[model samples]
Target: MTGTMQLAAEGASDHRGLIIGLFGAFVVATLAITVWAGRQNKDADDYYAGGRSFTGFQNGLAISGDYMSAASFLGIAGAIALYGYDGFLYSIGFLVAWLVALLLVAEPLRNSGRFTMADVLAYRMRQRPVRTAAGTSTIVVSIFYLLAQMVGAGTLVALLLGIDGEAGRRWVVVGVGIVMVLYVTVGGMKGTTWVQMIKAVLLIAGTLLITVLVLNKFGWNISALLGAAAESSGKGTAYLEPGLKYGISDLSKLDFISLAVALVLGTAGLPHILVRFYTVPTAKAARKSVNWAIGIIGAFYLMTIALGFGAAALVGPDRIIASNAAGNTAAPLLAEAVGGGPGSTGGAILLAVISAVAFATILAVVAGLTLASSASFAHDLWANVIRKGKASEKEEVLTAKIAAIAIGAVSIVLGIFADKLNTAALVALAFAVAASANLPTILYSLFWKRFTTSGALWSIYGGLASSVLLVVFSPVLSGSETALFPDSDFAFFPLSNPGLVSIPLGFLLGWLGTVVSKEKADPAKFAEMEVRSLTGAGAH
Candidate 1:
């Protein structure tokens, strides 16, 4: 190892005491917040929606906290350092996605749903079938998202501890799973929202700090930074161009398009994000909440221009890949470089603080995902479908807590197997699943008067099965060097992401099922739903 490399390893070990202290401090603070929030849970509303008490600005910060996961901080930076322009494209897809959520879905979703997405779908359809399908889709999409966040957490803990193998990452995954379970089962939405609010502030502050430092390194010259990044990338101007990563072959191009489609459409469909709308009191607050999020998130992504290219120029792509093959440690390594060289005190402090923030990002997102899935399971599936709305309020909340533990266990197992994949790419797959399975159902339920229960079932199940099936057979899972299980070779799908095919198919399935169904639409119910969804009349 070179001097900086050796010092980096030593610095990580030398600061082990500091690193662990920051980690412990963050955990204790968030746990205290969670426990305190738990006392506010006097009813189902408080448990599920934080009593709809948060202001637009507060909820917006929490949304930013929930939305900006490890993928935004670590994965995107690494991608930019390695792949150049294509890596920054992830930020674009995620940012523009909010526009869809804002203009089309946010107001109606907030007004129509009480706790879960199923509340909207079940309003004008057969309750049991629609609720069951919506509940299942919610859990699946949440798990896919949870898997990516946990994988990022595992990589982060392994790097900070200077652990060299998958074994260490696996232990981190297990530990994170336990902590997130506690966050949800004890704190519920109130605790989760507060933690996310804190995390969002830290993430923005940390990213802003790095962005300013990178600019200072180049004497505040943007051109110099880009020139150095391109030169250091070893690919000249190609690094700044579009084709560096995804422009290699037609298949790769198709995969890139698929990923873009998923990212843009997925935000509106995400169960956790949709549930966030219900945490506010009115349609106006929901709109205001989204407005705040778009502004904060837009500014943050703009800063990634510095974060990604800064890493490329200072840390070098070779050194970044050396640290983590997926470049998941790019941000921290860049933090270390800008603070000073590896062994410097400044480097150590910035590295530990940034890594702690990244860890907090992982914990906050996982808690939100657990709450979304578990709430759906208890509210939609257990209480409504199985118990026929006979379950008590306390019984439903108890079921949600149990579901959090079970879901956490499943996430731990999957996360251990997926430690090698890029966090951003894994998150894109989650987007694809959400876009394919949940988006169609949501749009149809809110807009199409003739949409029937059979249509919802078919759309949810068909889109979900098709997306997962294609993913299972795609090169992302096997048959490639970067595949989750590279030793296996059963993949036959041409594209890495299934969105190019699955999203369109989901829409088509919903329409076809609606036309073919023998069940008749009830105009009275549809009219009631339209009014409630439009004006927030009689919403819980």
Candidate 2:
């Protein structure tokens, strides 16, 4: 911490012009795309599935963008900067999760689904109850993840825009909520996909530029950079080891394993990411999209390692901690340090550009989340359940738009209150819920012939309930100094992430329910679902 570089707390005049110009340009371009895409939606399919017109490459970029939220870009980098090798472990888990998505979920999902994950789950079962369960799981996961993004948005604006008061940060959250609502309600999936594509490319380019600048400062020697990082980190060589973040004790190791499991299995279950498969035309395209997304995501995370270490070596942990207690500001502060220090013209411009890109990152992710929740509301709950499959395409689409506004408003309020939580940890809880609630049900539905409707209900409800209940009682809510309630300790669950227990419980309940219930499986329906899932018989 001795070599820590002081951050310049400059007024708005220093970088406001550049930040506004870049952010405004992105907003205008995305809104224009939304308007154009809105005109192309002639039915519910067009609105939810983007007309199934996107190529593998376009969907690939969008998928990468969707996965790499501010959590991946800023949170992981900051974690690595602060915790060293432990932070890099998250990068490994994130990239490896795509293998689960690509190999296990992508092709089957594309062949089976139309608009939502519920489509796949309810393909063989009695539709109403199954769809209701699916819709509930989808909304729960979406809201948890959405709140994390909203909180990250407010925290990022407060730090980057120099917003000092709580009111200022609250306004930032509201503004982001409005922008995301517009993206989903007007643009639908097509516009959101395009915006994600653009944001991914810019994020990759920005990361590369900062990485090269960091390397140049280190005389293009990686070993020297690592050496410097070790020296700056107070722990010396321990900074290069894995025990810094999660290796404190046996329980922490279990916690680390829980995190990895959630990160890996959760990607396939996430509603927003699962829905993206429907945007492609064929099963083959879906597979290819996943392959492309893995490549892009892999490359970006590799750079995050460099960015994190470079920040530790150059900007030092002390300044990063000072900027934000969670170290979420490390990447932006690194940009300021490498571009020529705070007051220099290069520093101001680069910082502003990166800040704007961060805003775009948040916008694209929240738009995807909002779109997924709205689709669940309209397609599953309203069209299929409430209206008994009699709702028209026009009515369903209108319902989705309205749902987007409601979901966005709720997220803004939660974000304003939850801004103090760590963005990365919040996202990890979201992944845990997705893995526990959605993954087990989908797998059994597609693979097992005896999976009855009762089994589906048990799996979804059991998983969702267990995840939510465990998290509420876990250390994140009220325990220790690091807990949300610093002065209290009511957490009974030792692990913060509930994936290790809940995922197994989800599968076990599905199996137990299937065996105990006398509701015989419909052989004809199972045959139909298997044929369609394997051969894309009825897939559009």
Go through the candidates in order and give each one's C-alpha lDDT: 0.92, 0.88
Ten residues in a row with the worst lDDT in model 2?
Answer: 1-10
Cα lDDT tens digits for candidate 2, 388-455: 99999999999999999999999998888776576778888899999998999999999999999999
Show how many residue pairs clash in every candidate, following the order shown. 0, 0
In model 1, the runs with Cα more than 4 Å from the true position are 1-7
Looking at candidate 1, the ten consecutive residues that score lowest on lDDT are 1-10
Top candidate by TM-score: 1
For each of the candidates, the C-alpha root-mean-square deviation to the true structure, in angstroms, is 1.3, 2.0
- Model 2: CA > 4 A from native: 1-8
Give the winner by lDDT: 1
Candidate 1's C-alpha lDDT? 0.92
lDDT of 1 by residue, 1-540 (tens): 333345566766778899999999999999999999998899889999999999899999999999999899999999999999999999999999999999989999998989999999998999998999999999999999998898899878776777656777788999999999999998999999999999999999999999999999999999999999999999999999998889999888998999999999999999999999999999999999999999999999999989999999999998888777888888998998999958788888888889999999999999999999999999999999999999999999999999999999999999999877899998899999999989999999899989988888889999999999999999989998888999999999989899999999999999889889898888889899899989989988
